[model samples]
Target: MIKMALMALRKLAEVILAAFTFGIVVAIISSAPAEPTDPAIWSFEDTFLFVFVYSPIFFLFIGIPASIFIEGIMKKINLRNCVYTHLVHFILYVSAGSLLGTMVALFFIAEGFEVYIVVWSTIAALCFYVALIGLNKIIQFSKEHDEE
Candidate 1:
């Protein structure tokens, strides 16, 4: 039982580290000044004048984690050892991101934050698809590499 506990803890650590990676990237991007000329980049990365205003939340909640998860799956490390670890990580991200977006949107709604829910939801979907494809590629590469 102790061994199982330790492995679970390790998986948790991986998730936390991945989340942190995404949080850092989001933070850096959020801190930068807005560039209004671009179409979609503006929404998440300084679409509004106050994008930086939400910088802390973006980094702490979203950026670091995502990157970590992406890196882990890409490297093909823990998937074999910790069954369901990947699924759990995927759930954690999608749930966490949605939760954050919903909470923030609520706060904004009070202050007249005029972003559409559909737009933010699309962002969530995009994140999911991107991760899915990337992981698939990693799996494909791993198979090819091992065949030799």
Candidate 2:
């Protein structure tokens, strides 16, 4: 049971780290100066706060619950460990990101919604996916090492 708890903690860490990375990459890449002499819209401090602080909060509210629901469904179907599951997750993340980003952008932006939303959302999805996968691999390696 302790081992299970440890693993859960690790997974939680993985999620938060991935979310932070995604936030940072998205914030940096999408940042732009509003005027020739003006500061970038997403300033360094804003990015830091958004990436390091708000990300975990958003992940708790949005990511964890969604992951739990999806994980339950995946476990039910016995596909949690299948090789194709990663691909499915990648596709799902991209699709959901695109849809949600587009909707939110549409509400706030009247022009150029297509470019920023679609591109950034896709990039964000990719960042999250890659970060999670890389972190999971590291966790798995450490677990194996501990067992040895």
Q: Which residue window of length 10 is worst by lDDT in model 2?
A: 32-41
Candidate 1 TM-score to native: 0.35
Best by lDDT: 2
Model 1 C-alpha lDDT per residue in residues 1-148, reported as the tens digit of each score: 9998964554444334433333444446455345546554444433333432443344434544654565566467455545476565666556556665666677757765545653453344344434444645766799899998
User: What lDDT score is found at residue 18 in candidate 1?
Assistant: 36
TM-score of each: 0.35, 0.65
Q: How far off is residue 97 in model 2, in Å?
A: 2.9
Query: Which window of ten consecutive residues has the lowest lDDT sum in model 1?
Result: 47-56
Which residue pairs in candidate 2 collide?
A: none
Q: Write the per-residue lDDT of candidate 2 for residues 92-148, one digit (tens) a residue.
A: 667756765777688868775666766765665566567667887887899899999
Model 1 spans > 4 angstroms off = 1-61, 66-83, 111-119, 122-129, 132-136, 139-143
